[model samples]
Target chain A: MEDDYYSIDSILSENQKIQCTFKVDIPDMGHLDGGHERDIKAQSKIQLPLWLAFILIYSDYVDFAVPTPFSSRVRNALNAEAKSVRLSALVGAGGHWYGFGKIIMRLLDDAQANEMSDLLTKTFRDRLAEVIDQAQHFAALGPAGGGGQSGDSALAFREGLEVTERELFSLAQESAKKTKQWYESTDRLRR
Target chain B: MALPVSLRNSITPPELELVASEELVEIIPLISIERTAFISGAYGPLRPPNKAKLPLWIAMNLKMKKKCHIVPPDWLSVDFLQNRLAQETSRPEFSEFPFRFAEIAKLLLDVASDDIQNSDKVRSLLKDIREARQAKSRDGLQKIDHSELGLPNLCSMEINEIRPFFVRAMGVLTHLTRDPEASSRRLDV
Candidate 1:
């Protein structure tokens, strides 16, 4: 569960990076020796986490790779059988599903990647609604009053899991909306 | 399988923490005893028909031994529990109650259902309240509204049932508003 580390802003502040390219050639800080410098040319592709990449990208120091999870593969999977596919498996495929999605959406907005952002938002909203439906269905199956001994206990446990899953979705969605507001407001401030 | 290990551990069922804090019931001693020593203190010299205000644990023990007849707690009355149940169902919110009202009621019902007046009604009402609260919590989880996080009275088992969901939902809301580092920056402003 990425619940603890799901904040997009914190992810950006952390040193993790996604793939990137160097825009400038600079001298090594410590030794100041050309031998140590090993002339790194501009436009050299580099891989870094989203956190580090966001800093460099925001600063115009480097351009980052398009976030991996927002690729054609994920889009196709969602369009093909969005409801049937388990959201946990999708999120599991990429370690930071909520966090990364948020970061990429923000980055796209900054870069004016409207088409990509729109696509991602539609896919995300659709997928999220499906997951909510699944949770509701799971909860509905349990014994309402919980009278029977063995069967009721197991059902109750399942109901708890379903409720928690729904809670996670609500949390993630709420985070997304908050981050969107923060990013939009900050953008306005910058202007 | 997607559930985190930490979450699974967090939901590890709450254990019943029975304490001898209150003199819950009185017991009339049928047999004579020189003295009975407890960690709290030594009680009684010789008694036959002496009513002692004993803690629930000791009273239950004495009652089990057939050496005394137990006087049940005041709230164990069926009318009171039924009123509480009605209040719970009629209102949109739950009110504050004894920490483990459900657990105490269950214990009393199990041990001396016959002893308590209108025991069947009490049992049924408790079950109704438990079910209503559980359903409410489930719906509330889906909404994820902090203002709506009302806790109804719960037994140990019911507490175990809702604790994980409550903690997880609240954790998400707390993390959402602000990151830790961001707060430090705000303090400077």
Candidate 2:
């Protein structure tokens, strides 16, 4: 729940430092006619290394940090939807608009894109429900009151934590692998 | 690290040694520019430049030094530097360069301390070096050969030890072109 693993602060600081250092303006080299003479001048001001930039940009969807204005706009839109849905007369209409717009729209439109969106929504919802169920079950089994049953409950909680950690690691590994493959495929296009 | 005795004692090939010495001397200022740019928050990105640009920048700087040409006036434009710094800091990468961000940072600090302590001497030296280089180009004469300048031979242990640093500096230049923002950020850091 804390999201401590992401270290967003460190990443942000690092980003700021990078911004201060490298001058990224590329001069229009097309007009320079001389061979190496022109090439050297053009070469001097390049900011990022091509291979690294290529890798970072093409790496993964989740890795993409939304540019500032877009993020703020999206947040405002989501907030507006939540307000409108809460005020609606129809039962569950607010939830539908605030939470399940893509799903309800797909169910109504019955188009291919909608269907895909529905499928994804359903999958995510099911997975989230499963996680909540597991957590609730553990929480219901209150702290040990000094008995064999209590000891068993503690063991169960420990096991659950281990399982969850493992799942998180597996997810991270899978994401990294997918990103690597995506980068490799896109790198070919740049060449 | 102290140079190996064999390298220290070995006589350098006159031509190649001369070239190497000249390269070493010319490289100092380029390194200075990079360091200054970095400390002044001019280096764009925090990340290292890509491999291609690294070598190219080094080669270009070397050529410029050899030709006694000034870096284009626009090279250090503020807007360009700021943009590049933004990019580099936003992304981090693994590189083959021997020194990482921490090492480079330390080196820069050491250089800055030494430079500030000898500000006038360094400034005068820089002015003379630039003037001499410019004069050579204007007079249509070959510049002072490395040996004539009393530089240590290219094959000398001291020079060899400094080679990697030069390569790293060159790599920074290359990164500047590829991810200016990242490079700029790294410099700022």
Candidate 3:
């Protein structure tokens, strides 16, 4: 219910690139990688948008490398301190890191897919409490909530959130603000 | 999808309060009136000093118009909220509260604080209980899995607060666990 077919976040996530190694040469497709030679050669690995990579992989023309956002390095960082990792920086704009992983999982064997899934779920669950806390504090603080060092750190944390977590943050903040609105609204009526 | 954030899969706090307003509460009438009838139900034949049961919205309206004294729900009092807050902070599971407790409490306290005994302390106690519950809920969510979660006795407003995050988290879980072979086959078609 949080997403739809027309969701811009999903669209942005699907635009993430995956590394694909060509298994068979295709004529007139060198333009895929700037078209310097006019023909794509066999075994040439190229980074292509996930949607394009899916088509190529399914057609038996290419095999995908695990996208760097879901790489072992990231797995280690997530295992180390999931809360401090900048998920937004991991997958470029919109930062649907989990969404991208799910798409990439469709191209993996079961064992590898499960590992990736577990990593993603773990990262999401681990950072959630922090996300909620930050949202609540910010909502409590209002626009003027930012103050000195803690505010700077909070701002850093906000900028690091991926799209899904950011959405949740805003939703929670909105809930807090609306609840506050009710209090002030009826405050005058109390006499 | 193009709709505003408020229209997302979430029901807002105020909307829940509106729904809570439909719940019946006891009110002491200040003037005589014949029994009245409206869409939700008919009630009254109110004479002076007699307590009558009416929906919270009607009660609030009359309280605002000085026609009745709204009697707060039993759970909305200072001692009860204090007891519940203690249980909330001390226990892992949520303490039992009426399904619409948060909304009902807010509406009552806001509109008729004078009618409620120890309204200021009750209000602060409610805040403490709320913060305690919010912390507990956040802590509980850390163990989120695709399987069943055991958070019993969560009130409507609490559920509303957590619903969006859970829905999306569950969606991702299902997506992650989907059979890859089947997914590729679907892509083939």
lDDT of 1 by residue, B78-108 (tens): 7777777787778766644566565456555
Model 1 Cα lDDT, one tens digit per residue, A14-112: 433467777876435213223454555567676666666766777787777665555677667767854443433443322444445545655653344
- Judged by whole-model lDDT over C-alpha atoms, candidate 3 comes out at 0.79
- Give the per-residue lDDT of model 2 (tens digit) for A1-191: 11134744222222210001122322454233333442224223222222233333333211222222123443354244322211112212121111122212211223543433433233222232223333333433334422344455434433333222223223323333332232123211221
The CAPRI quality class of candidate 2 comes to incorrect
What candidate 1 gets wrong by more than 4 Å, as runs, is A1-55, A64-86, A89-95, A99-191, B1-14, B20-23, B41-50, B142-160, B180-189
**Local distance difference test, per candidate?**
0.52, 0.28, 0.79
Candidate with the greatest TM-score versus the true structure: 3
Question: Chain A TM-score of each model, in the order shown?
Answer: 0.53, 0.21, 0.90
Fnat, 2 decimals, each candidate = 0.03, 0.00, 0.41
lDDT of 2 by residue, B143-167 (tens): 2211222222122322332232222
lDDT of 2 at A109: 24
Off by over 4 Å in 3: A1-5, A149-153, A187-191, B1-3, B147-150, B179-189
The DockQ-based CAPRI class assigned to model 3 is acceptable
Return the number of clashes found in candidate 1: 6
Is model 1 an incorrect, acceptable, medium or high docking prediction?
Answer: incorrect
Per-residue alpha-carbon lDDT of model 3 for A1-191, expressed as tens digits?
12367977777878898888999988997986995978999988888998788788888899878878877888898899987789999888768887888788767776887787778778877887788778777777766765655656567778899887887787777776666666556634453
- Highest DockQ, which number? 3
Best by lDDT: 3
